[model samples]
Target chain A: MSNNYNTDGDRMIDCFLNLGELMLRAGAEVNRVEDTIRRIGHAYEFERVEIFTINNMISLTVISNDGRVYTQTRRVSVAAVDLEKVARANELSRQICAHPVPLEEFKARIADIAENTRHYGKRMRYIASVVSATAFTVFFGGNWVEALISGAVSIILVTCMLFSDRLKIRPIIAILVSAFVMTMCVQGVTHFVEAATMDSIIMGNIMLLIPGLALTTSIRDVITGDTVAGLMGICDALLKAFAIAVGCVSAMLIFK
Target chain B: MTYLVQIIAAVFSAIGFSLLFNIHGRKLIITAVGGAITWGVYLIVFTQTENVFLACFVATMAIMAFAEIMARIAKTPVIILLVPMLVPMVPGGDLYRMMTNLVMDNSGQVRFYGHQLVMEVGAIAFGIIVISTAMQLILKMHAHITEQRRARH
Candidate 1:
């Protein structure tokens, strides 16, 4: 057996990768998401773990369930200080990943698949929200310039996502970046395509942003009797769609 | 030749999309075949009725039936299978058409194009509803049949 002491940085990166996988399985079920956060936090021996979805509109539930030791939940939004909170989460992940700890340090995490799922879901939701928002920005402007700017924004966002391990950018920013990318895509297609045929060009591209998968999955969740999760997932999809529409309309008004 | 190509493409695309979404095995194959058959039905109905909306509605029902049969045989998740199956039918091109019309300032065909857009969106929604309802019914039937089979034994 290799007697190697893993550092905090190593644990954080492992959690980061696991977070992506968890999100896909659990979607946004807070219980599962909270569990995932707890497992990840415990791996680094952090006392508290909080994951939130902050958007331009609507307050979100902060689902915090401690393993009977520390648990709390509250409503939160993206205020000026929220940026600091995100920065803190990023810093913790970065610090932990930089200092890989002993393998035994993650024993709790290995035994806590439920927690991993929740944390992953929370992470994915954060990514999805931001991506949707950015897409909205480009969607509304609907011009060659808007498209170019959006494309640039998408490039930056995707770069950040790829290097999220090194950069320690929180998942929430990734969500916003996705929104930006969608916006850029719609606008960019419209920009390059002839003005006489821009409507189809824009519409075709924007369809990719449609939460068809989410919508269908939500209904399935409802049918399978996971009503709470289903309702929340549907609500999240609706809110995201509304946000994209709002961004689009706002930009259109500005451009017009 | 074009219609044949469309059918093959729809099937292959449905299968590929399903795989991307993590569907596999017999159910996945059923979905792919179903999508191809639905596409064929869509072509025939549209040619006969000359109503794209109606053709789409009929095609949706046909595929939903296929999905139900596959779900019953497999006893696996229906939505997981059904969703990827419907990917090919999603009106990506129609959406693009509407957006292009709006952007290009083509005032002459605005009314015609706008109506088509609405109809296409509606058709997609209609397809989803039919498939979900069919799945629910299939589940109930499977339960009932299992009970009967158990009693007979």
Candidate 2:
């Protein structure tokens, strides 16, 4: 056990940092990220653990029993909602706390999680987007014909979004462009189909663009007392909302 | 009958959103059910009171409870379930209407929709804060009791 303790501090720090980075990039809020990291440190018998996380970055320090300190900073640039990864990471941390694993095995497990791909394929995502748009139409009291139009428009919008994502375009730009394309498509479709209200179709498809998740998470964070993270989340959500509104209104003006 | 159809649609929409968020396996079903419950409650309350804020508050509380229970059962974080389920209750429609009214130069309609949007969003935030704070307190109490019991032993 003493031998195990000798070489494990650096490796454990690396493992913890990797785990925190994965959770952060998977779109976890700041409080969860900080809590998970602190728990993992405590489980590993670290003397002290201090973690500070912002919207896109995490900085941490861990001190061992022998006066050794380890500090690391990781930048998490991507923010995609992959709940499976978040769930998997959360489970891993819990397991680490409950049953201590060796350094080699822990590193391997973290690697496996980091490399995990999404369960659904691109085609499935497109289909799901269409289904969601159609359902929103019905929920908003649109008829079957209007729902169908919204579904078609959703297909176009998702395609544009995917293409923009591939090009690594800024998120706000991508949202603005997609919203513009969505409204333009709706306008064209309205000219062709009689009695198809533009409001319902646009509203249905635009639901996909609104930053609902971000807004909710921000509020939850603020209420939980992480005011800075909450403010950042709120700003991000509002920026996206503004981009979408500008896109839609610009399209409306051009079409009118 | 129509309410049933709408409920089904809400479920489908939630499943689709779960797929988009890459939530898989049995958790998908739980999240979908959460969405259905939220929408069902919202629809009933909205129809009775015709007040979006009250409906949103009640629906948000219901879903937060659902998410908390599901998280404990599945041993997953509550956010994985909460975010997707909350999608249907989001004030997307009001935001769009607010923007549309602005474009048409309808100042009165714009103000009306804008006010509604703010109230609904505020209601959602308020509901989440209440439930989250309550749950945190309960968990703390449980922890304290366990600690005291251990000390007695």
Candidate 3:
């Protein structure tokens, strides 16, 4: 490790904070985000690095061996499950740990990563949503006709999600609206086609609404001893589930 | 024949989820296989014991083990594979049923589904903890033995 690299404290702090913000916004778990920040600090020859992360914020302090201290706090409000960006950021941290680079180079690399990685396009996402809903109908033992109905309902749900994303609606509200739309469509279709089983179709399509990622991540966090993060995740999942149920029930009441 | 259909459905569902998560290329197929294995084990266990909780636990263990091994081989985080694969086993249907029962004022059925939901979620959580801890221990032991061998050399 190079001990006297003459690195500016402010630039190092900016780089570290940028990495932390990118990872958190990309939906890396709290523990992983903290660990990455610590590793990055250590790689840059920081004497001590401390990080405290909550559900929506991160605070970090890095102390150089020369007794200079730099502290920064980032407020992260927009968190989506983008594992690809998380993977990219993880790889960047690993690279930083393996080979220390100049601040300018590091900033440029981060910029490139942020720009290059992209989410699946809107059309592909819609197709994936439809496919999962239709496949789940079969998994739930629904017949082919029911699968078709579920897939059609999923198309509407996906469009609603896209529109909600454009309008910057809250996730809870978006989920509720999507669930209501799905149930209403399913019910309307069933009225015309007497053979369509409403229960199976709704049940199958509802898989899209379930917070499986949050539930599993929360359980993993709790088991790993990050009780606070885990609890936050659980509460989020439960609230989303409640919203979905309320939406479905309200739609049923109106349609029935 | 029916089991085959179920397994294929699980595969398709997993692939769809992986795509939604932007998991591309070879990792996508591997994730689908992981899902198939989980659903296959789940069906076998459920059929033999008629116990949903145990079935979910055993299947979760299988998926976790598969994920750990795949993560090691692919050099990717375990979560990339684990999250998409576990989607099939989630009790989404039971949750929907529980809410429906509540709305219908059927307290008995609501309680029934609610209990099942808790047990299923608990069983899966327990399975994850057990497998993850065991894998970490095994990795540590392997590292220690390799260090000893290097010293002897």
Best by DockQ: 2
Least accurate stretch of 10 residues (summed lDDT) in model 2 chain B? B1-10
**lDDT: which candidate is best?**
2
Query: What TM-score number comes out for model 2?
Result: 0.96
Residue-level error in angstroms, candidate 2, position A45: 1.0
lDDT of each: 0.48, 0.88, 0.87
lDDT of 2 by residue, B1-153 (tens): 778878887887898899999998899899889989999999999999999999999999999988998999998999899988988887889889999989999999999998998888878888887888889999999999999999999
Interface RMSD, all candidates in order, equals 12.3, 1.1, 1.3
Stretches of candidate 3 exceeding 4 Å from the true structure: A4-6
- Runs of candidate 2 with Cα error greater than 4 angstroms are A2-11, B146-153
Q: Per-residue lDDT tens digits of candidate 1, residues A1-256? A: 1122222333443444344233334233333334445555544444444443212211122222222232223332221111112222333334445553454543344335433212223343334333332333233334444434433444444444456535655444444444445445545555564542233223323443455455545655566455666677678765654444444444443334
Task: Please estimate how well model 3 matches the true structure, expressed as its whole-model Cα lDDT.
Answer: 0.87
List model 2 lDDT by residue over A1-256, tens digit each: 4335435677678788898888989888799999999998887778899999988888898988776888888887876678899998988988988987888888888888878655798998999999999998887778899999999999999999999989999999999999999999999999889979888888888888899778877877888788898899999999999999999999999988
Model 2: how far residue B47 lies from native, Å: 2.5
User: TM-score for the second chain in candidate 3?
Assistant: 0.96
Q: Which of the predicted structures, 1 or 2, would earn the higher lDDT when compared with the native?
A: 2
What is the DockQ for all candidates, taken in turn?
0.09, 0.78, 0.73
| DockQ-based class of model 1 | incorrect
TM-score of the first chain of model 2: 0.96
